[model samples]
Target: MTFYDRDQELDALRTSFESPECGFYVVYGRRRVGKTALLKEFCADRPHIYFLAAQEAEARQREKFIEKIAEHFDDRVPRIGGWDEAFDYLGEKLATEQLVLVIDEFPYLVAENDSLPSYLQSFIDEQLQNTDSMLVLCGSSISTMESDVLGHESPLYGRRTGQIDLQPFSFQQAREVIGYDIEDAIRSYAVTGGTPMYLTLFDYDLPLGENIRTQMLSPTAVLYNEPEFLLQSELRNPARYMSILEAVATGHTTPNEIAGATGIDSGPLSKYLQTLRRLRLIDRAVPVTASAKQSKRSRYRVADEFLRFWFRFVEPNRSSIEEAPKVVFDGTIEPTLPDHVAPTFEDVCEEVVWEKIRRGELAPYSEVGRWWYGEHEIDIVGLAPDDDRILLAECKWTSDPVGHSVASQLREKAPHVRWGPETREEEFALFSKSGFVDGLADDLTDDWSLIDLTEVDVCLS
Candidate 1:
């Protein structure tokens, strides 16, 4: 596959690239999520210089940037020393012509020289602000970007014209990339979180479980050691980060639970959790109805599916990768992977169907989300945003057809809904990986219903 999704994002970036005068684009995301790739794709046909910054001293990185500029613009590499000199020269050289300049993993450069952003911002004010060059700053260190470059206190704050928080592929795109049903695609997405590089390993030809074993069990595989690579890159103490991730991944969502599980006190761990949440690796979510942003009952979830899979399966069992890697991987990780991903798989399905619903693909849904009464949670709830029509969908990963018993269970929970009886009427949809029960569709004829993307296609068509 030649990559998938991101069409809208690519179009947006391309439009920025061809901006009439000046433009600065900030693209940041968690590691291995394809920020660099997306930039390259966006700037493929344009006159651009793609400079990937590395972890070296400030002077050395500046020299590297100069050298790339020289190579791109001339035969001999430039002898520039400071980053300011390189930017100054580039600004001067491209003064008359439009060019795209991309600095990938820009946080590395910012880290090496604390004044780099100031220096660049000054140059932008003095030189490039009057030119047509499009400057693109890309980074995987979201926490660094937010704090150092985009933060209000930073010199570069408010300097960017457009910012792109590049995200992983969506479940629908994942299906298109390799081909799979909504349920299976969601299951895969729950594991890989729509990441293109990670999704590349999934074989459209094989079963998800088999693919996970083959692609993730091997020590040399991309995803096998993904967590370590990611943590080791952005963090000072990889061990502490690993402990924190494992605690969260193992179903300890509260600060107290994570701290207790990781052997870190809640007080100190709060800062680290905040950092992780800011970086978008983990999320602190409250029930949607809650008024408070952060409450005592708030839960933490690995917002990135790849990270969740890594923490749940890889991080906790690093020793397995060390000794008899496959034995430990297939034996322990594979066995627990399915149950761990079931709920997420359901959520992904809901998301894909929801998107379709929004585009008039799945009929007119007034609202969509997990509706609950006290403790009973509906897997999928679609409301007629305008009317009293409500859709209560139960997504089952099981092979059997959804039975009538589930309908009764839903009815019991329906009364708890604050909606008056006249305001809400229930519709049924049983999303099953193995297909709905015989007569199930016929029985739901009186109400709105759909299978996978069936309603999606009808509405869209």
Candidate 2:
């Protein structure tokens, strides 16, 4: 449960705190992504007042805020009539000393009193501009945070000196959190999806299957109802959004295909998809070589690993799970887990490629993603539009070693990717789970590279 990353974010906050002028910072991300944890870590050494807001009356919220200020500063609680008065009390303290006032879950306060932002704006403009104190507004509601506080039309716009859109951990960081081997780490990443809270829930002492059974499959488990809770909390109508997500997780990627699968009409499907995209639940993928704006062959996919796994395995088999959790995992989940982990393995391989680029082992590329056209598909493609160079890779998650035929097939599909000049430079890479055939190395040249699972671990590390 130890904090693993966010060095850059902590550094940014430290710099702002050490600055001479007052600092106004906004931090927001989806729930359980560690926004609060990061803020607490940053405030551990600083003189700060941290107040967590809840869904309550405005008066109750203000009373709690006053109590926190009083406790932090060891001063008597003041009689505040409104937010303006509350700021006046804090402003008097800021004039004498520096303080970091963080209101965690700022959206809840905004929900109760919509004019709170205006009061904070006035406080910043009129009182705290010259002080060395800081104010951090943190929230988990992405929509409310972006539209109400960070939006252009909001009264608090143009006031923030800095912002942190905290994100989930990368595959490497997730692996570090769970302390699993490369293969098991890949499987765990597929289930946890880089969410720090979920990763911390995993008992590293237990096996992966046991963890999945206890932490995810059981009806009493925390994660069993997690996806449902998140959807209900964030969206007004969770049923329709659940249906769309279920369709995408079960292989209905295109708009028409999802509409056919979910029985939601195509006209309104775009709106639902857009909302899901905004929530970071689903992603729209196009060919790596194609323009995202103009690409006709776009595909929708469940962006969250846990949600995709839940929809694919958990949601569809709730009855079976109720009957017997162990039976469901062994009979249904165990046999097909490799196939489920394959896509994540491809993603890890792509991350390895980027890591290589960072280490100067590979040249920089403009974009990297899967490439598909008609019947041809490439697992990983790196396009460097500036130098007319393309890196095409094939990732195999099978048990057997990849052979020359796989490389040959990748070569055959490379021409179908209409990128760069006909005489452009090309490179081929084959990423495998069980390494490559001994004979496959003989066919390698300066342009050909063979990467195995161990090499992937090393590259990413």
Candidate 3:
């Protein structure tokens, strides 16, 4: 698939390359997030040597690394005794000529030779720092990358000239990649999230449901077992983490609720949750009005849209899906897809609000997130504490057109959000899937906005 975004990342890399001194850059992210792709794109026009490491013996990896260097330099490479010798060889070449040496999956090399980071550190301090060449260390293992390379105690600390923590695409970028209508794009994003690999699997010629059946529900498809495969590869124990994720995906958001649902004791649950959060698979959300550190009402949510969809629909009905994929999707998935897409729709609406803020259509806000207290809940809230102003919004995904009652309910819930003073300014917005009633337009003012699905798409575009 074609690369859709990463203009900022490309610009950062270009700036580093244009520098006069040597460059040591670290790039890391989760699997299938396009780290390798981005690097390949950046190196397409530059003189570079790219080596992909694997989970093999240190000697074998070193041999392969030398072979890649020989191919790039167009010379017969000498045999190296150790990683230090390997870096020494590269350092000699880099001292005279400029080249980009990228070691993809650097964690795999560290797994075999634990002192690789120390050798590289010595190489940088002793040789590469004086040259005009560049070295890029890329990895998919977030934990190893952090603890071994980017951590304070690591020998390679303070040596990197730049770093890129690459992330998945946003809703708008994903929509552009899928080339679907607004509603179908929302559903596709709910299934594929923003992962480029998954988005590429979706054939634009097919409808969303057909794509789900052929590309997701089929037992042989890549996405069918992706969540399980990722968990097993990343965690030592996948079962416990899987249970916690399932609980969160199924609406058991609070710690107590998750503990009760997963049958795990509360004592050990925090560790598991923290691990999941570090992996970027789950997020902990608190009320917009409360401090995250002090909020007791924090709720855990599955961060990846695809994982949430899989745990909610695929994991539970695997047996039935194997028997009849079409029936399962038509009967089970299709009927409840709207409900499944509602939360993601709210997320898209929030993105629209952020766009409005960026374009100066709305006032700048310090923090923007969902706000909830007791029985009152607001779908989207933007708090501008300095200006003594608040933006409250209600997002409705139902088929019926939103009426004055929805706006009235949002107004009623506004006072419960104890953010600013009683005399502070308040702005309201209502996002609807089926548009709004004609009479509701009379409520529009300088402080009030009614946004429909079309407007949401346009604002984001």
Candidate 4:
């Protein structure tokens, strides 16, 4: 759909342009995360040359690159013999004219020429550093980009002035693009997972179930093969990764559980898990009260909503879906969808509430995340910015109103958080989809914050 966020990225690029020194920037993220969109927006009014590489022969790509730059300069460029000549022409031109040269899908070019990064490094140090050129390298292959382009051992590691590991849109940004009621917008984000390209495919006019059938469940739909494509493009062995993803989506969160479910040894599984984490596909989480460095109770969860949706619902029932899309959706997908989306709703609420704290609408906090201990759990937790106080919250995604019992439960569990001194202040918040129960709102004091779906939208605004 239309552009929604990235103001920070634009500001950074604008600062780079204003600097008298040459700029070398690196931008990378998973496919369809809006990296190219950000670059295009930043380069819209500048004197720029943009070249998008493909999986083609090196000679063809070189010719295409030359053609793009030549067109931008409005001058004919002679056939370039090698990378040196191409970079030399760019460096020489910047001596007089300020320009932005963006090379998208940079990993494709590196695949074709393994020495491309080194050639680029040599050019940056020997020629471009002293000039006024702004060079931006963009890519979607996380593994290659991190290991070959930004890693410590990389030839160009020290050359980049800045690096952006772009992430998916937050709930607020996704809501802006969906253009629906606050509740429906949250659901839309939960299913589409804030990928801009996928969000465009969903029709807001249709019911959620209908949209699911048309845009995702149908065999001919664009997203039908999305999960497979994402894994195949990034990993060499898609089947193994699929198994790992399926395991995580099905509640196999711990390392031992995942290994048992996938029948893979723990040694090899760790490598695969690391790759998945680096790709931003899954996340390792621990109790909010526990130290990230010292906690041995870590668990892995699917971090992307779309991937989780696919693995949890679609992948498990693929054969049934192919045989009868409507039947499978009605019986299996629809009935279980609420429970499936509940955790995502909690995540969205957490983000919105965090924004409030940042904007001074709520009590400021130093840290926030999910908290759990033994058999007790709290959906959201915010540590006081400068003291020993903590904020605890529970997010409910059901249609039923949150009653006094929910508040009472939170009060009971507040004592178990073990954050600081026993007398530490504990503030509570209750976020609900269907609003608070009768008399429940009246019973709560000013110390409690009650947020419904509508309040979430308003607070975000």
Ranking by TM-score: 3, 2, 4, 1
Deviating ranges (above 4 Å) for candidate 4: none
Number of backbone-clashing residue pairs for each candidate, in the order shown: 6, 0, 0, 0
**RMSD, candidate 1, Å:** 3.3
lDDT of 2 by residue, 97-139 (tens): 8989999999999999989989999999999897999999999
RMSD of 4: 1.6
The true-versus-predicted C-alpha distance at residue 209 of model 2, in Å, is 0.4
Model 1: how far residue 287 lies from native, Å: 2.5
Question: Which lDDT value does model 2 have at 229?
Answer: 98
lDDT of 3 by residue, 44-85 (tens): 899999999998999999999887877777879898988888
Task: Point out where model 2 deviates above 4 Å.
Answer: none
Q: Per-residue lDDT tens digits of candidate 4, residues 64-99?
A: 887887777787977799987887776767677888
Residue 166 lDDT in candidate 3: 94
In candidate 4 the C-alpha lDDT for residue 86 amounts to: 85
How does candidate 1 fare on TM-score? 0.87
